[model samples]
Target: MPDAKPAPAQALSAPQKALLKLGLTRDIDLALHLPLRYEDETRLVRLSDARDGQTVQVEGTVTHQEITLRPRRQLLVTLDDGSDTCTLRFFSFYPSHQKALAVGARVRVRGEVRGGFMGRTMMHPAFHAAGGELPDALTPVYPTSAQLPQAYLRKVVASGLARADLSETIPPELLGSLQRVVHGTWTLRDALRYLHHPGPDVSLDALEDRSHPAWQRLKAEELLAQQLSQLTAKRERDALRAPVLRTAPGGLHEQLLAVLPFALTGAQRRVGEEIARDLARPVPMHRLLQGDVGSGKTVVAALAAAIAIDS
Candidate 1:
């Protein structure tokens, strides 16, 4: 039978190319790219009730729109709800923005409200045509580059989350033990979903500080992965072979130890013997000698070097 040819690689879209630049080629990678912060767009507030310096979402009909070139070319739209009115200012905007905020168009806008002689104003606020059902959860703002729009990234992230395998990686027994310690029972999938779009009622402070149960679950998994990687590296190192480094009895190692003016501490003597034993093995030795300042580590190194030279 003839050998089969490999499948051709498909060309990537611009957004997909941007995602690759962010090292998010795998479904798991995209699933793990969590939001940097959240924006509250779950409810609409009356313009009269909205306070200065507060980030809020307001829905109103555009009463007027104009392009003024006095300070710089800018589009200004006046929005009026039944209670009050505010100005939506945009230094940079497109035809789509003009159409969305055209006179008599009902739109929903979100940004920090500012009060001055100009009355309540929102600079470069995000807006769209109103009349859709409000989201039940807070909107997530992710870390992204210029090429990826939030809408496109949100769709792709949702797709990735749905397709990625999120089965528990930790052993059931170990996971249970950690869960008890942290007083958390969130599963991996549950954690990711909640973190991506937490309910509006969830504590924002807890999420921001990473003290929420979902955050704890993710942290535990990350720590476990690091420890497992270290263990795997150690096991692989143990399997490798190396030249047996041995010195004859009462050779340079012993001679050096006997000639030292200061006697070795009980702790030093114990460690020195252990290093000597490791050097006599056929496998490579990986040992770290640690001590406080002035703990006689210099003499230990001298002894080890003597053994090596003699061998």
Candidate 2:
């Protein structure tokens, strides 16, 4: 048998692993790489009971199904999950995948419930192999895009959860200290992986019923890294940006502004004076500009350009 396994993606990292429970996260492996808020999937309700706009599990035989191509090469599949049928739209479908979705099959659909005309229960269904009744609730939905199919996205997350080589960014002693301080149990890496793919869905008690110690660690580390990066960037700017030392008596500055074709406004006059003073000082000039919706900051900038043009 050929390797049905998909190809490799970006290696999982600490920050990514922490984001698993977030609905099909914007980042795929981030939840597994960082850490997580424990997730609960035991909270599933039947499709019949799922309300409009709520995520409901449709577990039924897919009796009637149809596929049609609309204008501009679009593919649409309408499916029924017993409660009611809804259109399952797929923008890009390969020849093989379409053949697999034909009618007369048992399938599960987890999708958002929507209201339809004539008070019919409808869903934007995601097809899957039908299974037994769900015993739990609060299924974590994921983010999806056209480039990545929801099925492929689900598989990648499942793969990341299955990986045992999950690295812990939080230190042991720090973890222990966190457990003692926060009065919680699980380490950082364990929390994130277990949330999306726990061996056994267990009840936890602590912050948000979470015993994962990695939340604080992950947040603190990421924040510190960002702060340090900012600080380093500021230091680099300090070294690289040279002060204008243009502090000569205001004679040359006045002469340059005098050459402008149009007369200057009071605001422009004030700004020019400020820039001239800032340049004369030993300190570097790093000015932020504010312009109204049509304030013409460009015109103001042009006046400064005249100085260089004159020089």
Candidate 3:
């Protein structure tokens, strides 16, 4: 049976609906909406310690703001985090943005560092005025649309996680076997929870490298799902009857085999037999022969085609 459609979240705001462009209106959707990246907001980096090309977050007061038109039209603002000053540059900025960057206004900026005419710079960085308090754990950077409040989205997703009844996909026996092999103890829900709401102890390096145990578990689940999908498709395809194309035993089949310069390898011979069986079916034989450069796939294909001609 086809899977039941997920029920939509109750009383979604207009902006919330707009943000969910991927048709993710249900609690399950929220549960499955994995983060694109994560921000380690456990601590802020000093502007002086920030390295070029590395993504970093810094909090400081906006010390300067002015529009420059020498090379091209751009807005340049200076931020001082007490440790050092960094330039916040923008090529395309609005008057409101200029107003927001008023001198002495404290803001938090997160972006990749680059060397500019004015020393260390961050171009078009994600910035917002200083709020009440910063998060002490990993912060998720979700896929978003314009005008969507991130705080609101987080709240919605948190609610979903609280209310959604997540059905187990993997069998308990198989899960236990996999756990033994990997030495992992997380279930599907645990994996998602760890990813979505990682504690302070979770390493920033492991999360960034996608090599954490939680990430590995999720990756295994994804790979297994993909494999099962392909196998299911193959089984469905094999079930249909095909036209039998059997040739007489010692006729053209023997003639073609005799003319071949080299004898087929054991593996090739087995594959050839399998292909021969597939060709004898009433259903179309949709097969793919994949191997390295020196593998005898071409020769085996030629043999299979010769059999088709003989019939």
Highest-scoring model, lDDT: 1
lDDT score for candidate 1 against the true structure: 0.91
- For model 3, residues 190-209, the per-residue Cα lDDT tens digits are 87887888876787788768
Candidate 1 structure quality by residue, lDDT tens digits, 209-281: 8888899999998988999999999999999998888877899988997888988999999998899899999
TM-scores, each model vs. reference? 0.84, 0.47, 0.74
C-alpha lDDT (0 to 100) for residue 105 of candidate 1: 99
Give the TM-score comparing model 1 with the true structure, all chains together.
Answer: 0.84
Span of ten consecutive residues with least summed lDDT in model 1: 175-184
How much lDDT does candidate 2 score? Answer: 0.55
Residue-level error in angstroms, candidate 1, position 303 = 5.1
Worst 10 residues of 3 by lDDT: 14-23
Whose TM-score is greatest here? 1
Candidate 2 wrong stretches, greater than 4 Å: 1-55, 61-107, 111-124, 132-147, 157-227, 241-244, 256-274, 281-284, 293-311
User: What are the clash counts of all predictions, listed in order?
Assistant: 0, 26, 6
Give Cα-based local distance difference scores for all models: 0.91, 0.55, 0.82
The sequence of per-residue lDDT tens digits that candidate 2 reaches over residues 221-254 is: 4665699898997777666655454423454556
